[model samples]
Target: VLKDDLVYVADLFIGIQIINVSDPNNPTEFLRFGTTGANPRDLCIYESLLYYSTWYGGISVVNISNTLNPVEICHIWLSDRIEGLFVSYPYLYAANLEYSVSVFNITNPSSTYKMTEFHESVLVFDVFVVSNNIYLAGYAHGLSIMTLDKGGDLQEISQHFFPNHHHSLVIDEPYAYVGDKYSGLHVYNINCVANQRISVSLLKAGGFLALAIVLIKLSLKLLPKILEKLSPYKRGYGL
Candidate 1:
């Protein structure tokens, strides 16, 4: 559920269903559409586009700009079972159970294609990414915090194991909420202190660079005065 009084539900074996939840009691079925494959694992919406991770069907993109009628826009086939999806602008990430994680370049919606696919040892149940940081809810691997390297490859930072089967995760600033089949909604305060190390180092490096520039400028300014003071030495003054 997002801002536009709309509800997008990934209807497992059926497909993607859109409902207008403005009225909580009597929600209206706005529209229902099927994907290329039978199972619609996850739904992610960005602006006017709706991204659907259809298991074995790759990813299906629909133009939901018109809420009343969502038209199929594009499809990218991966042949692997896509368990979850996360849309971060120019990129659409798909979490696969068997083939692992797949990344798609969706900078141009019309020409969306698979950018890269990599397999990690962990069981990928769901994936969420904000900026360079990625969060994955693993069935056996528990909760994994991964980061997207500059080369767009996922690198695991840390992982925590809960006493339940982890299903999905949602992040809210300083805290992260995990959905587990055994434990229900598990709330854990995200330890961002470790994540901030890189940022802190970058800030320190920036400050050093600024200080160097300032010192260089001061030296340049004082050089003229020093030369003026030593001018007599150079010209054999008082000789």
Candidate 2:
């Protein structure tokens, strides 16, 4: 969490710490607050609250209104591991280690509900939401953009294959910084009319290439007969 001149970082078992960087050259640790999560995988800070998704520990919400002495407001146990987190208004998106991204309604922090789980049977590694659009990065499926319907079912809008496997992604407006386990980091310009045009062009190019290959094969098949007819030794042998 970035708060003006202070930077809050979580060191998993070591808990969360506040670092004072009023002067960038000389930084100092200001405060340290303990965490209840066994192994904090990832966390997100919205407003004055800090939410963490832990490995094999579930989710924990902390009140960081007072960073020096932060309070653990609540902890929800899912009995499974969580890798990524994104807090949007009244909801918390928990990217599970398995194949689902669990959605939790956090309107009433004290009484949170497990709303739904999406991308089931797919290796969903990370997820981020922009307005109503949710960007999911899967192990094999790469990056997929989706939105939830009225009944909370996922509807895929568009997708991009990240070569081998997509591990994570971070979006900033028109650009998305994606990470692949085999290919490293990549920058993709998404959510624009230009991208749609590129998609159409790629489709057209693929169709043309397929047609060219078919024509080449047909020419090759008739090449032997044409060669025999063109040559003066046409009836010399089985040619």
Candidate 3:
């Protein structure tokens, strides 16, 4: 997670490592915070806290107000191993290797509880939230779109099945970008009625190792209005 000039990484081998990226050309390691139970899988930041997932199927919250000396605030374990973690304020969404995407209400870290689990008979590698829609990378099952209702339930909105293995997903306005294991990247027009996909092949050069979608300030400002028009409440809307 990027915070100012520092980037906090949830390293599988070394736990949370802080890197100073103020100098884009030559980045240096700022500090390292070791985690006990299991190796870290993913990281998410909100306010002064940093949330990280573990390979042993657990989540840990750390107080990162002081980068030099970070403290572990709380840690919670789940049933299945978590791969991807996305934090939207009070809600924390986790993608598990064992056929499910779990949602947790993080309003109170000490009293945090699993709100709901969207169980699908497929491996879910990543979970990303845009407005009320939950975009999931369901391995070979492709991208699954669901909506988070007021009752904290995840209801299916749409599904896009592809042959490529969907490993990660991110949405930017009119399009949804999906990272495939075999075939580089896949882009779909979520604004359209049929949701037209515009595949951009990046595997020609080499492997598609990482995917990052950065939204500029202007794009971020326009997102609220755009998402309102494409809200999941509308029937027959394809996303």
Candidate 4:
């Protein structure tokens, strides 16, 4: 839906049915690219390249530079089911149902190389990358944030736990909007990690403050008894 020059969209029913949608009201079928499997679920087009993730099959990279004769460049095998994908620069991040996210080096689109794997407790359904951080919709595990180095190694920055399953995530500037299956949509402010760290510090400070209050109360109650026993007449006070 991002491309305005997109002339056609393959229906993938009988084949890759092309519709000339130059005009929204009067769209025309131009061509078809036939294949032997189910249609693609989600796809992204970058320049002349088209990337798609399937249900039964893995990720498919196609050369759509020439839209008329689109050729299959490669099919990366991933046994773990995929739900969503986001490609940035030379890296591709896939949200897998196997409670993890798979990172691939797609610098050579014809041969996708598995770079690294990041695991979590809940099912990962969708993910998006902004700068070096990857935001994921972790079902049952809530929201997971990870930082990826230049080499594609993932370091789990932090995670926010929710009561329900999260299905989708969308980020706009400094905020992240997540869609939870049972709990509905949730919004998070991602301006900085300071907010997360602040919460942790507050909890620790609260515990320390409680301990101080308890010690002060105990001292207040015991001070009178100690003073009474410390009188010169009380022989036990000297010992």
- In terms of lDDT, the best-performing candidate is 3
Please write out the lDDT profile of model 3 over residues 133-184, one tens digit for every residue.
Answer: 7888877787788888888798877776776677765567566656666655
TM-score of 4: 0.71
Candidate 1 runs further than 4 Å off: 192-239
* C-alpha root-mean-square deviation, each candidate: 21.9, 20.4, 7.1, 23.0
Best candidate (score: TM-score): 3
RMSD of 1: 21.9
**Alpha carbon lDDT of each predicted model:** 0.63, 0.63, 0.69, 0.62
User: lDDT by residue for model 4 over 54-132, one digit each (tens)?
Assistant: 6566788878767778899888876667766777767888888888898888888888878899888888878877778
TM-score for each predicted model, relative to the true structure: 0.75, 0.73, 0.81, 0.71
Residue lDDT tens for model 1, 1-239: 34356667777756877778798899888888778777777777777888887767778888988777788889887677787677776788777888377788898898898877767776677776755767777676666677778897767787666545556655554555455544344555665636532111111113334434433443354445323321100000000
Q: Look at candidate 2 and tell me the lDDT of residue 190.
A: 73
What are the clashing pairs of model 2? none
Candidate 2 structure quality by residue, lDDT tens digits, 1-239: 45657766656667666789899899999988666757666667777777876777778888878766788878998777787677777778887867788888888776767888765546776777777878777776666677777886667677666444555555554655455555444456675623542121111113334434433443355445323322101000001
What does candidate 1 score on TM? 0.75
Model 2: worst 10 consecutive residues (lDDT sum)? 230-239
Q: Could you give me the TM-score of model 3 versus the true structure?
A: 0.81
Clashing pairs in 3: none
Worst 10 residues of 4 by lDDT: 230-239
